[model samples]
Structures are given as structure tokens and as C-alpha cells.
Target: MSGETNRLLGMAKEIMAQPDGRELDMLASTGEQVSVALLAIALQALGKQAVSYAGWQVPIKTDSAFTKARIRSIDDAKVRKDLNAGKIVMITGFQGVDADGNITTLGRGGSDTSAVAVAAAIKAAECLIYTDVDGVYTTDPRVVSDARRLKTVTFEEMLEMASLGSKVLQIRSVEFAGNYKMPTRVLSSLTDPLTPLAEEAASGTLISFEEDKNMEQATITGIAFSRDEAKITVLGVPDRPGIAYQILGPVADANIEVDMIIQNQSVEGKTDFTFTVPRAEYAKAVEVLNSSVKAHIGAAAINGDTKVSKVSVVGVGMRSHVGIASQMFRTLSEEGVNIQMISTSEIKISVLIDEKYMELAVRALHKAFDLDSAK
Candidate 1:
């Protein structure tokens, strides 16, 4: 798939000086269209009734964002009709039509978002996401040999993990499912589809509300880590009202995301502010700050480092537990790892660390929190 995209990108570069977003979406959407058509044909060859439909045919309406459209609404009239007629219907994913009828493709991994949106529109009982891994784990199994498969996880924990870098499901899809209270299962595509539903439930992890009594009770559900993080610090800024906004407003205006912001305790009348951004945007964010933001805000200097990563411990049980944060800090310190910045929410604690120690921090935290033994 990546090779095909690269080939198309090369062709576009050769054919046009600069391809517009609309044109790019139009070209990229053909990939999903072809996939659904081929899959439909394969099913028909097996003597089953199957049909393929494009996003416009089923009318998955989205905003006119071109390459990163958000689903505005989905009209299931044609889908329901086709299913009622005893035919298995397949629709192209990752592409939707705007109200203006222009072809728009969702961003990378938008197919997962499209599937979840459709399931919500139809009010399906459960949306099973079949992937290479059997289910969500205590940690990345490749990183930890004993990373156990979770039978069930609360939506809050799943959200934290997905956003922090578990990558089993798209973060937006998880948010959409949680909003509508949709049940999603992450199971292996290698399993037989004809298996009984009740028996198959044990093969994958179920993401449900915390109200589920069967959810495994644990202080820390998992440790998630993300690399390619860069830190930026603005030094000697007046510690007054709206100082944060003054420093970050330009980055936001330029569409650069800021994460894990921390302001040092005020010293005299000034303080130092620090934050992290994706490594790809680190240079751009620094340029924005150094160019004028520093002088305008009366800050002394700006500094940045691109060799950082974030580690987070997530669990719904943390809301009612004590000492989780201290335990996490102690575990990292005992492993000779240093925390660069810290951020926390009700159910999660995240810290920025040197990228080189990311694996060490995750492994130490996993064992410290007893995640390896979690059911």
C-alpha cells in the first residue's frame, strides 16, 4: 500500500507542479475503491452474494477538508436496503463525499475511523477490529515477553493507551466509540470467522465503560511510550496572567501541537516555561518562538531538544488508588532514569524522559506497577 502511494505521489509530482489537496484526495481515494471492489469480486467467486459500493453511493457525508475530512453524517438508506435484500455489501473506507459532492479522503488510518463511524450510525452491537495482534496487551508484547492479553479494558484506559501509543486502534475511533457507548473488540484476523460468537469473545480484548464489573481490577492497566518527542523551553518570562497563551499562541496558530507543558516555580518576578512537541515540528515551533515571541513576551532565551520520549501509566483504578505516582517515580529513579517533565490526569500519569531510556523506563514501570501479572 505504501509503495502504491509512493508511486502515485511520484506521478503527481511529474504531472503537476503542485497537486492540490482536493486532487490528492481524489487520487488517493482510488486505493480504497479498488480494495473494496476486489474483495467483493473475491467473495462473489466463492458463490456468495456480494456487492461493492463507493462512499458516495452510500452517502458518507463529510466536511470539505480534502485529505483529512471528518465524517459529518452517514446516510444508511442504501446500506440497509442492500443488506435487507440478502446481499453482503462492502463500501469503500477512508473516503467520503462532502456536501459539495467532492471526493475527500480521511487522513492516514482513516479507514478505522470510517468503520467505527459506520458502526455507530447503524447502532451495531459490537465493532470487531481484526488486527495482527490478538488483543490489547499489558504492554507491547514485542517490548516485554510477559505482556499479557487483557480480557477487558475500560474506555478511559483504552483512550489513554491509544493516545499515548499503544496503536491497537485509531485514537479518533476510540473517542467516537466511547462517545456513543459502542462496544469494540480487538481480535486477531488470523482466527476463523465462523467461530461461535460467545467463544470468540475470549480471544480478543473488549473495550467497555468502567461500569463493567468484569473489568480487571488493577492500579495500572499498562505502560505506554511514544518516541520522537522534542522539548522547548522559554526562559526568563514574566510570570503573570496569560503568559502561557502568549508563548503558545503562535504555535497553535501555525497548527503545531504542544504537549506536556510545565512552568517552573516563579523566581523573583520571572519564570521558565517548558513544553514538548512532536519531533517533526520541533524546528518550526522553535523558529516561531525565537523570531518574535520571545521579544514580545520579554523572555530571555529559547532552547529546544529533539531527543526525548514520553511514558505514561494508565488505569481507571488509579482514580481510587494512592501512591501510584510515587511508585512510578521511584521505579524510574531506581532504574537510573530521570524524568524531564510531568503531566497527569485523573486516570493517567505521563512523564517525559530521554529517548534512550524509554525502553528501560517502560520495562521498569511495568514491573513496578505489577502490570505483567495483571489479569
Candidate 2:
């Protein structure tokens, strides 16, 4: 409660306004409402008239899902009326109203989504996302301090990074910006006012279309690592049509995501199948499969290991590149990184490696692909 009070006070100060005890108590939905109000006050202090509004006030209507609600529509008439009234409208980013007329909150960092949605609705020239970091880095700075910051990145690359584990931006926000062709700039909130918003500046990364003609699209963009993986192996199942479905249907019904499936050729009319799932759901997955499929298929047993990690190299450039997979395997092999399983998409090649080797594997791949260089 004290933390929330201090946050509201700080926001009020930034906006050059005295803290409103009543409004704070009634209107505060998330920390972002305070931020919007503060920003509005700052704009007002700069001689611009600004109006702060909450999600309920703006009435950003969304689905019934709380804490991850998808925006169904925005009552643009209300927004246009306010903007035309010479008011710089400030709105809470991640919260919305559901069909049941209930207030819903979009999950973590949904502010980015809110900002882009506003930009699209208002047809703004650009959307600027301010954050603590100057720009996206080649690798996490904490893990690789020398990781260089990228001046600019394409939407495809940004999406891949966000899905892979880059915390700089959210994936849905990027998708929204790209779909509308709304120019987006990511810059440090702490940077000096004189710093330009171009990719050449030490400001945040600019996510936009690439214009270079000779930039050799590499097979891999950057290495992404995740430790939330588990392996499930079903041994000695009868090899026949529809057997795979029989084994995986229940798992899917239970909403467990299965990744990197491998099935061996039939040996004496039986086959061993293996796949990966999120570690947190491994036990439920195993139990479901063992109970439902084991007796029917006369399989040997169900087994799993929750201590595995997944690392991948993602880049749309890989569509035209050859031998990238070979190079990646060779590099990891040189480092003695034992790969347990492998999977690939047209743009990404992922491998399951021991959790202990994650850092070394990423560093090795970073060097091998020359990712730290300013290519």
C-alpha cells in the first residue's frame, strides 16, 4: 500500500501536479494510469492541454479474459471527439472492459500494446516506446556485458527475439505496429532531450523496415535460450497409422504444448516416440499419456526429464541461406555442448541442450555467427 502511494505521488510530481488523493483512490487502475496522468501534467506544464483518462473512461472494450484480455474494439468516436477538442488524451494502456462490462487487465508490459493501439486509432505519425535500456542488445547484457545494442531491427527480427526471450519489447505490440505500418521508436526514458530518435543515435532501437541491398541475410539472427523444457519419451508403441494421433490427442486436449517430436523406426513392430513440453506441465502430460495410451498401445513405459534447455538461432534470412544448421552443430560440438534433441522451422533451428551448458552454448554461437559485429 505504501509503495502504491509513493508511486502515485511520484507520478503526480512528474506531471507537475499536486497529488489528488480522491482521484488516486477512485481512478487508479494500474501504475500506468498514474503514468499517463503524470505525462499529461508534464504536457500541460509544457503549455499543451492534456486530458488524462482511464481504460474504463476511454472504454477500450476487450474480451472477457482478464490479465491478458485482447482488445475487441476501441470507441474511436470518443477518442476523436476528445482529440479534436484540443486535448492530448492520456489513457491507461493495459486495462479494458469485457462483454460482461467488467474491468480487465492485460498482462505484464501491456503498456506497449496500449500505446500502439492508440497510435493506430488516432493515425499518429509514430509511436515512441520509452524504456530503461537504450536499445535491444545482441544478447542479454547481464549474461554478456559486451553485447552490442542494435540501432535498428526489422519487425520480423523483433518478433523472433521477443518470442525467444528478449524482454525489450512485447510480441503482440510489434505485430500491431507492423500491421498498421505505424512507425515505432524505442528510446531510453533517461536519455538527454537533445538525443535524436534515429538509429544512429545512442537512443533506443528503432524498429522499422530494412533498406540495405547488400546485407547478406544470415541463416540465423541471434541465439535465444530457454530453460523451461522437459522431454517425454513413450517407448515401444505399435507402429501404425493414426497411432501418433492417438498418443498426442489427449496431450493437446490438456493444453500442453509439445515440441521437437522424434519417432524411431519400428523395431519388431514397436517404436519409441519422444517429444518435449514445458517443464511445468510435464507431470500432467506424462500422467495423461500413461493412463490413456500406454495400455492401448502395449508400450514399454513413459519417462521424462525436466532439466533440459532449448536454444535456437532465429532469422528470416535463413530462408535463402544454406549450411547454417551444419555450422551451428559443428560450433556447439567443438565446445563439447551435447545436443539432446533438435527441431527446425524455415527461419529457426532449435536444439535441446543440457541446462548447464546454456551460457557457453549461446556465447559460442554468438561468436560463430559474428552476431556481436555491426553487420
Candidate 3:
């Protein structure tokens, strides 16, 4: 697949032409279609009654967004009927069609989201995700040698971890599963699927609601980190009402997401505002803020750094716990790591620091929180 995609892209580059989102989507969707057809063929060869359905055939409806379409609804009648008829129904995972009958593809990690959406539409018992890893780990196993696989994790924790850059599950899919109250399991595709379904499930990590007993045992469920962050600061802005909006309006209009915002106290009626955006959007965000935003909002200068990282500790038990924040600060301080910006929610606390300290911060925090062992 990689070779094929590279070849396709190389040809496009040679032609000195750029493919629009719609064309890119159309081309990218063929990969999933091919996989579904091959899988269906393999199933039939194994003596199973099997059939393959494209997204348009199953009718996974999504918005008109060409490359990053969002699923609006799905028609499950075909799949249901096929299942009742004792035939396996295989649907292409990521691509869908809009109302105008235009092909659309979801962006990165869309396949996982598509699977969850289908499960939700059909009211399945659970959605099992077959990935390269057997289960969610306390941290990236390659980074932390002692990282342990979790038996179960609350949806809140999983959502936070995913948003904080844990790649075990896609953040949108986790949110969809949570919204539909669907049980999800993470299992490895490298393992033999012939294992009894029940036994196989036990070997994976179950994502459940916070009311479960297992969810209340840990204040910090795991450590998540991402290096794809950049910080931007708008300095010397008047500390008047709606200043935040004045500074961030253009950024939002440009479709750039702002994360980990900090507004310092007014100093001589002026304040320094700092925030973070995805590294890819760093230049665009800075440009948006510097062009008209600085003058309109009465700001002095704009500064940005692309070499920043965010690390977070996430858990449902955080709600009932105390001293977790202080302990986190102390742990990082002991490591001689300086925190740049901080953001917190009910389930997570994320801090931005120099990118160079990302791994050291994760390892230190993991050890400090005792995340290498299961609760």
C-alpha cells in the first residue's frame, strides 16, 4: 500500500499538478475498497459465506467535506439483513458518500471511527478494534520499558489519553463510543482470530464507563505525550474585556485550533497572552495573529516556538483525588524540566514544555505516579 501510494504521489508530483481534496479522497478510498474485497475473498476461500459492500452500497452518509468528512448517519438495513441470512457482511471502513453522491474520505484514523459509527448504528453488543497492539499501555511501551498493558480503562481516561496523543485509539472514535455508551475493546490483529471470542476479549483492554469499580482505583491512569505542538504568544495586549476574543478571533476564523491558553494578570493595563496550536498550523496561526490581530487588539509583538511538547496525566479518578496536580509539578520540577503552559479539565492536566524534555517528562511522571504497574 505504501509503495502504491508513493508511486501515485510521485506521478502526481512529476506532472506538476496538485490534486484537489475530492480527487485525493477518491484515490485514497480505493485502498480501503481493495482491502475489503480481498478480505471477503479470503473468507469465502475459508468456506464461509461472505460478501463485500462499499461505503456507497452500505450507504455511510457523511458531510460534503472532501478529505475530512464527518459521518452524519449510516443505513444498517443491508448489513442486518445479510447477518440474519447467515452471511458475513464486510463494509469498507473509512470512505463514505455525501448526499450529492460525491466520494469522501475521513482523515487520519477515520477507519477506526467508521467502525465505531457502524457499531453504534447497528446497536452492537461491543466494538472490537483489531490494531497492531494488543491493548492500551500505561505509556508507549517502546519509550517506557516497564509500561504495562491495561486490563480495563474508563472512557473518560481513554478519551483524554487519545486527545493527549496516545495512538492506541482515535480520539473521535472514543468520543463516539462514549456518546453511544458502546463497549469497546482493543485487540491485536497479528494474533489468530480463531481463538474463542470470549477468551480473546479477556486478553484485550475494555473501555467502560467511570462507574466501574476498576476505574476508581487510580488517580492517574496513564501518561500521554505529543511533540507536534507549537506555542504562540501575543504580547502587550490591552487587558480590557473581550481581549481574548479579539486576539483569537482571527485564529479561529482560519480554522486553527488553540490549545492550553494562558492570560496573565494585567501589567500596566496590558497583558501577555500565550497559547498553543498544532505545530503544522504554527506559521499560519502566527501570521493570522500578527497581520491584523496585533494592531486591532493593541498587541505589541507576536512570538512563537514550534519545538514544544505537551504531556498529560489522565484518569477518571482525578475527580476524587487531591494533590495530583502538586505531585505532578513536583515530579517535573525534580527533573529540572520547566513548564511553559498548563491546561486542565475534569479528567486530565496537560502542560507544555520544551520538546527536548518530552520523553524525560513522561518517564519521570510515569515513575512518580507508579503507572508502570496495574492498579
List model 1 lDDT by residue over 194-301, tens digit each: 998788866799897558463345457798888889999999999999999999999999899888999999999999999999899998999999885998999989
Error of 2 at 70 (Å): 1.4
Alpha carbon lDDT of residue 77, candidate 1?
81
Clashing pairs in 3: none
- Each model's number of backbone clashes? 0, 1, 0
TM-scores of the models, in the order given: 0.94, 0.81, 0.93
Residue 150 miss distance in model 3 (angstroms): 1.1
Ranking by lDDT: 3, 1, 2
Q: Which candidate is the best by lDDT?
A: 3
RMSD per model, one decimal: 2.1, 6.8, 2.2
lDDT of 2 by residue, 153-223 (tens): 77777776777677787888888878877777777788777665464244577787655624475635577
lDDT, candidate 3, 1-375, per-residue tens: 435544664666677677787878777778778878998999999999999988888899999999899999999999999988999888887789999998898787788998988998898988999999999888887878998888888888898777888788888889889988888999898888688878887887889764747545546778988889999998898899999998888899999998889999888999999999999999999889878698887788998899999999887767567688889999999999999988888888899999999999999999999987666
Which has the better lDDT: candidate 1, or candidate 3? 3
Highest TM-score against the true fold, candidate = 1
What is the TM-score (0 to 1) of candidate 3? 0.93
